[model samples]
Target chain A: MSRPRVIARLDIKGPNLIKGVHLEGVRVVGDPNEYALQYYEEGADELLYIDAVASLYGRNNLTEVVHHTTKNIFIPLTVGGGIRSVKDVELLLKSGADKVAINTAAVQNESIISEVSRAFGNQCTVIQIDAKKKNDKTWEVYVDGGREKTGIDVLEWAQTACELGAGEILLTSIDQEGTRRGMDIELIDAVAKMVNIPVIASGGVGKIKHIKEAFINASADAVAVADLLHFKRAKLSEIHPYLISEGIQTRKVLGK
Target chain B: MTLNAKTISILDYGIGNLLSVQRALDAVGASWTMVKTPEEVKLSDKLILPGVGAFMHCANTLEAAGLNEAIIEHANSGKALLGICVGMQLLFDYGLEQGRCDGLGLISGYIDKIPDQQDDGSARKIPHIGWSELFLDEECPLFHNFSHIPAAYFVHSYMVIPEHSNHVIARCNYEGADITCGVQKENIFGLQFHPEKSAQAGLEILSNFDSRI
Candidate 1:
């Protein structure tokens, strides 16, 4: 098994970094690139950039940010939001993003997943599923940055997306998003068990222990932190050591 | 061939992350040009083939662009040539993705999908995305200054199986199945991962490649 990745997710609106609670009540953080560079220096395994308002605007706005980030940062960068067609995938990939995560467009047209995967290899395509718990054993899928509920079962959609050729699953829990509590361990465990692809748990990382719990209890292959890392509550430098001490494998922190 | 030689050529066949590779080369302070035509391939001191797409389509594109012959001719002339990801797979004799497709045959090997199931009958994920440690099986100059590189980021479903075991320079263990991660045959080299996107360790590898030319 590969080491669990520690990814820093940056939710962007235009050029500024934004954060929200339960995927609502948005506020600016700072320049997206500045945080991205800080995370990169702090030994983030990968970087995820989502244009939080791209779908609402009907087009992606993170291309320039992606282009600039790729020029400066060397870690794997995944860009999502408003990825509607093969051309959109092409544009982002050309802009230097290693992978493109699609949610809203993918739920609308499932074939878009296969199309992008076929054109640019399955590894280049990621399916982002914003899920909210419906009951004890079910979660409803959401699109357009968790604003629209699709009523699709999270497990069912994840399996279908994997079958359709999504290399990885970026599973974000809406109920716990921006709550600064902890990741939905049940949600991550359920999806991680169902899908063979790497599942990145996102949306509810409060402390360093939460990250470790996501990997240990949830069986997540990667844990993505936005509020924890973005707001300066938890540093990746500190997180890596804590994870290593807890017997979880992670990439060596550079310049230590 | 001095160690600090700056000029490098990256083949562009209408696919792959050419700019990322260019940015990496730039970060290493090595001058590079995107080689689109056959003439540019001939004029380049070293060649880097960077790709991120299907195997058959990339092979078809190389044939359509007449890059296949150019790459082979350049390799025959003893100029250093490196292939990244699907670019690395294209250097093989054939690729099994989307049926059997012919490759550059620069190295005697074939590209095939990584085993879907591990030794314990557990499902192994396709694409094998994320960082994995590289166990160097052979000595090569490309790994110079690699003491600090614990792992390089990998994002691929298929891997190359070289016919000659000696050609396999490095191996990465994926759930007990040892997969070939690097191939070296004389001046020809193939890396299954994206060094350009693999942080500082990746930059060191790129710098090593630049120094070899």
Candidate 2:
């Protein structure tokens, strides 16, 4: 059986990593690279670097961060935010990014997904979907840094992204994002059921139990926790065993 | 045919990070250099193809740089050659990515989209990224210092399925098909994962490649 992957997400706005109450009142969490190496040493399987200001700034800071991070760490890094074209993907990869995530650009120009995929290969392109539950019945998709509402159902966007050669789906819940209430398991389960590719469950993780819940109920191949890890509330050394006890397959703990 | 005293040439296609790959060679203390010219590739004992991009673009860029024929010549000279990710796909005969395009044809195979396994309405996702275990088929030099089920980082959607299964050196099960993660022949090797970014297992794989040459 394949082992479940544990990923730590770091949301960067300028030089600081912000922690908030549901993506609102953000507090700086110190240098992004400093936090990255912390999780890396804690045995976090992968690191996600999302430039929160990319859409607002009209550019991605991945090239600068990735170049800086890859110099100190050896783990794979996936970057997202404001990736508008294949050239953007090219620059990120050249700068040592293992994978590039596309959200707004892929939704606006679906062909860009295939175009970038064809130019770089599908493995390098990741489609990040930020969904907010509008009500009990429908969820709206947000693009351009969650500033614009597409009104399109998040499910439809996810299916289309996979068809366009998006290798992985970074499914995030805007309503649950940064809440630490728990992962929006419903959204994760829904997306995981639809996409055959590896689905990474993101948003609404408050504790180690939330990670376990995300994996077990959502059946996600991996889960990304931002607040819990960023705040040093949960360490991977303890998380893996907890996951194993909960019937999740994990890579053999290296030291033990 | 012996590469007893030769330098390994790493092809710098200007698409992917070559420094980490170069550093891996340096970590094992292997005599290697990044070769941008055809002359460098021809004289090397081994060739390392490292790249990140669409198959056609890489093929085109390589041809444009006058390294395509040089690659063929290197292989024809019986020099060991290895390709990573898109670099690995370039060793095949053809690729179906971004329309039809020709490859180096060093090995017999083609690159195709990862077939969708969801019958219920999921689109087949491209760019499979993450770490996966290698189910080694035969004991090759690449596994010398690595554990049996060493984890390596991967980031690709399309993969090489050679006509002959004998050429498959390692595999990782994704969806249902045993995706061809690694391929090898007498003097050629290709991996769909980035060994440079794959951590210790990755470094070990590079170390084994160095020892083999």
In model 1, how large is the Cα lDDT of residue B60? 92
Q: Across residues B11-104, which tens digit of lDDT does each residue of candidate 1 receive? A: 8889888888999889988788777888888787789997777899899998999888889998998889999999999999999988999999
Tens-place lDDT per residue, model 2, A61-173, is 67887777776566778898888888888788777677788888887889999998777666767899888887764678888766688988988888888788877889888
Task: Kindly provide the TM-score of model 1 when superposed on the true structure, using C-alpha atoms.
Answer: 0.97
- Chain A: TM-score in each model: 0.98, 0.95
Model 1 over residues A38-77: C-alpha lDDT tens digits?
A: 8998899999998898887789977888998888889899
* Candidate 2 DockQ vs. native: 0.38
lDDT of 2 by residue, B1-213 (tens): 333345777888676777667666776677787777887777677889976767788888898998889899888877789899889999999999779999999999899977754455545443455666778755777776465347677777678879899999889875455788899877889999888877667777877888865
lDDT of the candidates, in the order given: 0.89, 0.79
